[model samples]
Target: MSMLNAMRQKSAKAERSCVAPGEAGCDPVSDEANGPRRDTESTGSGLLQAVLTRENLRQAWKRVKANKGAAGVDGLDIDQTARHLVTAWPTIRDQLLLGTYRPKPVRRVTIPKPDGGERELGIPTVTDRLIQQALLQVLQPILDPTFSEHSYGFRPGRRAHDAILAAQGYIQSGRRIVVDVDLEKFFDRVNHDILIDRLRKRIDDAGIIRLIRAYLNSGILRDGVVLERYQGTPQGGPLSPLLANVLLDEVDKVLEQHGHCFARYADDCNVYVRSRKAGERVMALLRKCYGKLRLKVNEAKSAVASVTGRKFLGYSFWFAKEGVKRRVANKPMATFKQRVRQLTRRSGGRSMAEVIERLKPYLLGWKAYFGLAQTPGVWRTLDEWLRHRLRAIQLKHWKRGSTIYRELANLGATEHVAKRVAGNSHCWWRNSNGDIKRVLTIAYFDKLGVPRLS
Candidate 1:
């Protein structure tokens, strides 16, 4: 009988901790303020009134998050994983790191096409030597433990880095109008046939080709939620970044050959020409380039705006309304928050708070997306929220623990009132404290962004 009672208590406590309407009220997963289970001392209003509905929860979440920047998560895993892969190829890495090996061997030639048109070009022979060097050069830096997943690919902010070079007179601007080009799903959508064609041009060894094919094709999804699964081969594989780097390097050569001066750091590409007429020529060349590669640009999310502090790969590329601006690696939190607000606002009033509230679904889907280590940024935000709460409670005994918490979102139905209770634990908590003599009054009282407890 005692064991049965204990079991019931445990089950009830589990039920109470969720945010959905039907279950026992749980705190926000992003808030991490939910303490160990304690028996509820029910106020006259009961726990139901305390919980917020999903709609209200969404609203409040956006209001807070839009005002604050979203954080990077599981970025470390990509770093460490990349390091391990690179270090696995030591000789190539050493050669590339020391700059002792030349990966791209320049071969100048004129080739005849099926249309009987011949063109002079400098084609790079993609040798094993080049491949190894490329991998090593890209991988060695990321191997450092400090590198986070957010740092994996070359970021868009590299343009600002080049702009600095122009400002410093290292490179003359030369009346160039620069247009940035971004490809949609560069890796995931890579056609195996195209890759094979490219690979065949370099190596004739059938064994090596087979080995590479199997290695590249083995992009089997890791065990996880279906939507989050990625192919294990070159698409989502550890070596894909390096491969993509080499591919883009080839693309860069093609762009420059057609009279478009190019600057590319990873997938973020910019084409610069000597005049506005040249800029039109550059854009035309870009279309040709993408068409040849069987790739397309996502023009909707991408733009040719007079760039400001546009973030790419976790760095800030600040472009002046007219001239190029300095390349700053990290923007202040305030700057980042403003950009987040702008992006959210531009999202057709997707309503920032609601998007943040919806972040729970992503937070819960973390296991599906990257793995156990790659949780949503909201979890850390929640922890910070809890620490504040604990400080107010004057509770010094609390210590942090692993974030291996279970999903509370999928627990109940959207139609059920209990499910509604489970979905919005915040309202539940607030309503529960309605009659309490001393509960902190939270209000958006100041524009300085002080989350107030009046």
Candidate 2:
């Protein structure tokens, strides 16, 4: 996974290459049709052949109009990765991609704990497994060679999931304290002026900042607009993550000054400390650093909890019962059916049953989150993709009894609420008589979309 983190740009070309005569064996038909023939122009020198291939080779080209995600940065190729390499480090680039090159030896260092503690930490070598797993799940569509660049993480969805899992793992180990720092708008809210200044502080390379500025100004947007100014790119731009990562690399200095006791990727950050006071001290230093950089923390959505159930990224972190759970509400009969149909279409004609099967893992977690007390089938249309592909059709009669029954039971008024409402009566919970009460109400709405409560 760490190797994946180091791999910033992905190549667009499919993994296709010529097979040798015996190793993978070339195609028999092609081999038989075009047998090797001596060329009078070819020389015996290997260097001569290399020069000829480099100069004479006419690379294959594809039409941008006929393909999806063709309008890449600068209209070179859909793959900007190769170009980025050539521009950034031409010598290293040529040796890596076009010629043979050996990687530098891994560097190591020793570190210490924050809070003026006595513990010393040794910096270990970066491993590939962490990045492999993270990017494998984050970029799952990459498994399909046909997938386009647009399918990449345009938002902080998968990254957030990874962060939550990392935090949850620590909590599950019986750690008594945990503090998660939430940077308010780490992307858009980031101060570019401060970032540029910080970048200069970290690396004396002005060219890198120039490159970053170019990326920021002319990047792509989902609404199909090219950035006309430094900050014109939409929040979902492809270069946003890359640029944000480079900027946050400066934050590592402050982290090291305070202590690099936690792990992070992009804006999804988790600061782990051994003790509660130590955690608070780290948070204080972080707050000071952000203040110095003209950044503020969003404390409302950001929380510090020893026992909380929240979904970080895709991993579920549960201390007690407050972990994050994915949810879907049942729509009206007419609208619900339409939604199921739409979901199926969006999932590439996946059948309803097959869709459900794919969603079972997430849906099962949702069921647990909802405190299943009534409905037997919680996520009825969870697998609409598979269901639609399979041509499975079923009309479900959704009962509103689930919420009413559960709320009443939870409020400890099952007997009282049942007594007040007659047979076939519908009710919702409300605060009445100095206690939770089930107020009779109808689930359906009139033309105004307002429910009638009685």
Candidate 3:
């Protein structure tokens, strides 16, 4: 009887060892075709186990804290993370281990666009964000390798400048005809089935894939209602960027396989060819290819234009005497000017000193970002315009004609010039360009330590 019991126990152990991937404890192999899959460190347990490891969760928490986003529908924030996780984390982990984890609905909000419309955004719970971040760190190494070299949106060690330089190189080599492509409602229209299918082609980890699917179907909390999101990646999800890239990578490959010189930053892409005819052909190919993926191109904004006036990564290009030149595009330039105008508004009611302080940081930030432009004249011209704004601020501060004369003279403006300028009540803006320059000279701005774009 004892020998028979021992033999039965050994057989039971074998049955448990061969448990399927979906089960709690199973060692699944990496085969996306039909069987269970594995990530780098699958514990026979799969990506579910790999992602919930202590080290992975800790790293995820660190990133979640560092990013410091707003509260979701739960109203939990980074500051409350440690306290909330004291007991909640273990339960959460257990659910993940048991494959019972369900992401909370994302809080939906709308924000104004720069060009004058609103865009939808979804904010996930801080805890959900932590998990997503952790999962992303693991998947990034696996998926990023397969991405296109020409695509540079939100990837580690990649920037808009990288995309810009790639396009610059292409244009300099004489691919002047450009297909400036734009996607229509990209984030709101990502097809969940297609995204998951593309993902399976690269990663065989079924657990992580299910977690991602849960997120897509997690629903949106908006206006006190839960709306299901069957398709579309939420804009603010930590995992969304990487997921979007997975789909866009196909476009990049299509461009590459077709032998077109192109550069892409997120949804913005520019395909360059040697002639107008080639550009037209590339455009046709993109429309048809994008449709197959259930992606739509913004037909009105998508155009074939010369590299001379074409904009990519916020910089427009044209051939100068030496070679191709790039500068801040018109839209961004107008936006910058509008921002400066707002900061320097005479009716803003801030003192000249306060205005100077506010302008300092804005100017420094703008210069740091846009200073890469090869056009120094635009900067010099912006500097001149900025100083005019400063002078107008002082005039507005004086408010009264008598005070204006007194302040201008005190600031070293000649009495004759100050009197003549202050006498015209309606010429404050007019005088800012006139004799006010004599009062607030470049030397004066230099004394105040104002930032110069040039």
Candidate 4:
């Protein structure tokens, strides 16, 4: 038989053999002629019961269509899977319901980091990705409420800014010390057995549990060759973030039980206390809890210091003349400047308009984020620096005094003024603040689609 005929035959068999509701066991495949096996009974409040619904499958298919990732170990891209999903959904859904669906091995790709190193990223097969999306839709509501308010990370309607704001509130309320904790290789360090064991307490469906276990165990790293990954969840898998948050729920509970004031954004945690003694107590408790959970702490990055002295989620809390103030940290600002310079570099061989077009998104996003903090001075300084860089780029683009003079004249500069400005100096900084500065005003740059911090 052809592949389509074979799949249709299998699906038809599965549907006919599927156990009905109120059966002893919900197992799709069972030896019992009368009903399903007792162990497979669906008695829990878990949302996996809705997995096989056509609506849920459609939703899953929509998510797959929206993704922009590459093909997985199965060598099927989103477009290819989409083309086959209409024909494939029946068998896939039947196998999922029967607890017989096996996920393909995860494809690992290494991404280059800023410091010239690489990080492993796992991509799941298109089918598995669809299943993961469906699972997320079902599980998110159940798991979202269990997450702590101070923990932000991947949760919807929460962000690093929220974490910073929460920490700032505590600091304003007289929390003196802030203990920052960094988890060492947090995603890669999760123990699969422990994660599954904990998951069993909340979820009771065997099919769902089996699916999760398969996802956890299906990771395969190939660096020009297949490599072994003995433990921990895959970092880049669709389900990894949810699993990591679920696993860390225990840590949140432990901190709450000890009455520790804390804010967590994924593996980055900041514990606030009234004094050094309280900070020490919280830090010790955290160490014990982490030890019990087999999580490693990066001691070098972790520190218990004054709230004014530490930075969390790229924002720093400090006492100013008015009150406690929140502002962007030095490191992130420096990095932002470096990125802007790199993107707007004169020698990059891109046109001035092209460079500005590329920088619009980055500039807008960075400004929107840091704008949350009260930093008008910082914004003004950055705006001046950026305008100067643009001026330098424009000068480099002009390349010749004749071109510069013509450009200045075109911008309505008087001929004499343009000649003087163009002949002033070859130095970009001097020229940017001199004649070119007048010709290319902030309004002029704005007209050319250059984003400015205000």
Q: TM-scores, in order shown?
A: 0.37, 0.39, 0.85, 0.88
Query: For residues 261-360, what per-residue lDDT tens digits would candidate 2 score against the true structure?
Result: 4556565566655677776777787777678766678887555554343323323333335532332222222333453345434335454355545444
| All models, RMSD in angstroms | 26.6, 18.8, 8.2, 4.7
Candidate 3 wrongly placed segments (more than 4 Å): 1-46, 112-118, 356-361, 405-426, 446-450
Better of 1 and 4 by TM-score: 4
All models: lDDT? 0.36, 0.36, 0.79, 0.75
Higher-ranked by TM-score: 1 or 3: 3
Kindly give the number of clashing pairs for every candidate. Answer: 37, 32, 2, 0
lDDT score, candidate 2: 0.36
**What tens-digit string does per-residue lDDT give for candidate 4 at 1-454?**
4323434455556556665544554444442221112243554213444654446656766766786688887687887776676577667766565555667777877884322245677888887888888888787777888887667988888887888888888888888798788888887788867887778787766556667876776648476555555567776666788888888888888888877788988778899998888777777878887877788888898888998777887788778878788888877777788888899998898888899999999888887777777878878888888988888888888878888888888889988878887785477667787766677888988999887787
lDDT of 1 by residue, 264-342 (tens): 5546665544555666666676777776767778776554432332333223333345544333233333343343343
Model 1, which residues run further than 4 Å from truth? 1-176, 222-236, 274-277, 305-324, 327-454
The 10 consecutive residues of candidate 3 with the worst lDDT sum are 1-10
Supply candidate 3's per-residue lDDT for 399: 80
Which of the numbered candidates is closest to the native, going by highest lDDT?
Answer: 3
